[model samples]
Target chain A: MTTDSLKYLWQFALLCLLQVLIFNHLNLGGYVNPFPYIYLILILPISIGRIQLLLVGFLLGLTVDVFSDTGGLHAAATTLMAFYRPLYLKAQSPREGYESAAVPHIKTFGFAWFLPYAALMVIIHHTALFYLEVFRFSEFFHTLLKTLLSSTLTLAFIFLAEYLFVSTRRRR
Target chain B: MRNVLLFIYRNHVFFVFLLLEFVCFWLIVRNNNFHRGSVLSSSNRLVGNVYELNNNVTEYFRLKTVNEELALENAALRSLLNESKYISSGRKGEVKDSVARQHYTYIPAKVVNNSTDRRNNYLTINRGILQGVEPEMAVLSSEGIVGIVKDVSKNYASVISVLHQNSSISAKLKDSGYIGSLVWDGRDPQVAQLMDIPNHVELAEGMLIQTSGFSSMFPAGINIGKVKEFHVDEGDNFHSIDVELLTNMSTVSMVYVVDNLMRMEQIELEEQAQTDDD
Candidate 1:
């Protein structure tokens, strides 16, 4: 593997360790559940094949799911996200099939499309995750509130971590 | 052919999407089996071990906050002790022999792991079997009762917190003798519902509720909570009451574990009767 791929791999491993070691244990309240594990899927290199991205997303989510005892909830949500990447990218036509030469940073995806792109993905993933855990619509509003609160916290974590740790520069 | 493989590769994302969704749906359905396979099942040992590790690191950082809480709690406890003395002053009525007043002790156990985020929440405490803690023991804070232990291993035990939808505490109104089930609506932590009280009975806000000692799980007169709002449901015969729980379960640090001395004997007798009837 090249230095670029190696760094991405290391970053992925570090994110998993950080999430499982720290965030998984935090139930801030009935509403605030921080899900930093989504970082693994969020920052995958654009050069990777679409099918490969799907496989990687499933594995990343499955690993976190098994550890957190959330079973297939994460796997299901993340795989859906991986598959929808093309459609979302297609919607933001300027960033369509974003070349590997460019990073998936706020600069590359543009400010207009960046926040909603990440926010949409995070919202879908959190909704699916919290709903599957409850396994019922008996208290829809309550669980829906949990999903929204946690998704916002998760989005903040993702944006902050990317800004602080991940450089917005592509590898050669 | 090469062309077919290429075509399949091009559509791989769609195929994988369907594949994962199908598998996920199957597993989610399978996980619904009520007979077994819950948060603490034997099948969950691998995930359970991982959570135990995660809990260790998280709890380590919480030590400082926990100590501060404990200190404040201690000072409050001292005052409460003084109050108890004052209340029982000049009352020397014949008190029966009670091991509970003597041997029942409390050890501070911080909640190393908890799941208020989930509908059916489970709490993992730092203390376990090695610490003389056993299953079916009632765990509580200075405020009120939390829940009873349902499982135990050598080093750790998971508690089904009162916030769980499945939890049913036997609680009665302090002003009246009406007892009902205190259960969570799977929403707010501060609120829970006291169900099954008949509409004929008068219920009031801010009225205290205590355990009825109906179940071996908890002792009699343990403070549950006070009524927040209550009224008969539309066209219903029972009162649909909401309570503001006394214990702040979200931030509880040190807790007393209540053990019923004769619980084993009672369970054995009940089991024997059950077998005889069968």
Candidate 2:
């Protein structure tokens, strides 16, 4: 496999492991479940194929499901987020357009550009996941509150990880 | 046909997305059904091993609490031993030993993975089919009822915790004998709602609740919780009761899987009665 593809594969594995082992156990106030695994999809190279993106997203989420015993909850949510990523990127593209090999990272794009992108994606993923899990509209507002809280927590973790790792890699 | 093929080729991403989502939906529906075994759960060989390894590391931090719980349970068991109780010699043989047969057997297991925050929570334990654990068996901690086994792999099993929305345990008040179905409201991990107790029943705070044994899953008289609060709604026939569960689900690590030896016979007779009525 190409180096880029292999790197992505390693990332996929690491993120899945981190999610199942640590993030899934973080039940802050029994409401916020921060899923930073979606960061893999967020930072994937801008030029990655749409089909590949969806497949990777599905696989990553399925791995999490297998560990968490949540069936297809994560798989469905991640796939939905992956499917919308390209369209979101297109709509939010800079006037000069993205660099040829740029990955969507806080390092590449400033906080102003990256914050909204990551936040929206996390919000969409968490909302879809929590709703699909409950599978009912009876507690709509309650679920929405949970979704918002979890999304905020997830966004915080994602930003923290990006800042920590990306800056260190740049220094090297 | 050419136009259709062109259209399909133009939007293949959407089609793929639809296909994957459909598969995921199918899986979710299938997994939701009771007693339907699936390899996608934590009880799978690989997933179970991963959790077991993680538990090995975290288990050290919980050793103090675990030891305390074990000691309390040991003391309780010791108190129940024949040596600790003074039995009247005259009435000892009055109850024939042959009449009292063993009905439930408990197999001890360690919790490998557990979650209490989710709407539908589950726990994975180390014991499974290989250890005589099976679907529908009752799981209990030293303090009180834990959950019921939903699926079992060879070396691991997944339990549907009492906190789950689908979980409903048949329980009754210790003093007044008022039966109700205990269910979690998905809001608090420490409390659950007991339904179907009529308004006329004299309810009081701190009243003990225990399993009714109406269902064969659990033995009767196992403590579930105590009434924390109760109120009758306007024009309502029943009282809304909140129970403070004795066992803290989030901290439960050691559990026992209860095997009902006569479950098949009971089920067979019940099925026969139903069929005869029809």
Candidate 3:
């Protein structure tokens, strides 16, 4: 694999480790458990194949599940997040469209574009995660709180992580 | 064959997503099974180890509060044991022999992970199959009944909390002795809906509600909640009673798993009777 692919793989592992070890334990009053691992999916290069993206999402989620002991709740939710990521990207695209090799980061897309993009992905991921965790529609509104609160928190953390790690330099 | 291949190539991304989702759903369904031996759930060794490690570090902060609660419960239990009137009743032959035979044992567990915000909330406890905790056992806090054990691994177990939509506990009015089913409406965490009580039965606001012991999971007289509001519909025969649950589900740190000793025999006899009728 190229150094760039190797770097992405390392970043993926770091995200999973942070999630299971720290974020999984951060249960704030049993209401908020913000997942920052979606940042890994967010930062993936746009040039990656759709099939590869799905596989990567599955592997990323399964790794998180293996540590947290949540069975496959994360796996299913993250896979759905990956599936919709492309559609969401297309919908939020600029008038001229996105560069093929460009990674969607706060620095690259600006907060105006990246904020809504990350928020939507986080919301979708949380919705799927909470609903599947319950596995029933009877408590649609109750599960909505989990989706909303967690999405908000996850978005906050993702922004913080992006601001701290992602560089402002343009791709060569 | 060529057209089909083209179709597969064209919509391959969607197809891959569908297949991966299916696999994930299968994993979720398979792990939800209580009797599965090969499954690695939250209660399994690896996951248990991580939770335990975290608990060890975090538990120190809550030590004083947990100790105080435990001490209060201990005092209550001690007082109950020391009461001569209860023992005297047994000596006077007032208590039935069968009443003495019925035993409900409790296994104490620490709540490692709990959630009250979800539509269906599940609590993961430190105690599991290794500690004699099995699926279908009743879990409760010091104040009230919590939920039923849904799945158990070696060192951990997950409980289907009473706040869940699918959770229905057999409960009754303590003073009037009118039984009903207690369920959550997914709106308020502090409140649950107690339905199926006939309207004719008189129920004032703030009536005490407790377990009816109709089911094998929870024993009779376990405190569920108290009625906060009730209204009888003009056409319907049942009363819509909103109950304020005694257990603060959000903050519960410790719980007891209730194991009915005679559950197997009771289940077997019930199954046999049903088959005989068929």
Q: What RMSD, rounded to one decimal, does every model reach?
A: 5.5, 1.7, 3.8
What digit string (tens of lDDT, one per residue) describes model 2 on residues B1-278? 99999999999999999999998898888888988989899889899999999999999999999999999999999999879977667654465668999999999999999998899999999998888998999999999999999889999999999999899999999998888999998888889999999999998899999999988899999999999999999999999999999999988999999998999998999999999999
Across A58-88, the per-residue lDDT of candidate 2 in tens digits comes to 9988999888888899999999999999999
Q: For each candidate, what TM-score against the reference?
A: 0.74, 0.97, 0.84
Candidate 3 residues lying further than 4 Å off, grouped into runs, are A1-35, A62-73, A87-101, A126-153, A169-172, B28-40, B83-99
Please tell me how candidate 2 rates in CAPRI terms: high
Residue B152: error of model 1 in Å? 4.1
Worst 10 residues of 1 chain A by lDDT: A63-72
TM-score of chain A of each: 0.88, 0.94, 0.93
Query: Which of the numbered candidates is closest to the native, going by highest TM-score?
Result: 2
- In candidate 1 chain B, what residue range of length 10 has the lowest lDDT sum? B34-43
Candidate 1 lDDT, tens digit per residue, B2-41? 9999988887778777887887676545544433334433
Error (Å) of candidate 3 at residue B269 is 1.3
Give stretches of model 2 more than 4 Å off: A168-172, B89-95
The best-first sequence of candidates by DockQ reads 2, 3, 1
| Fnat of model 2, as a fraction | 0.70
Ten residues in sequence with the least summed lDDT for candidate 3 chain B: B84-93
User: For candidate 3, lDDT tens digit of each residue in B3-67?
Assistant: 99999999999989999999888887776665564355555666666667777777889899889
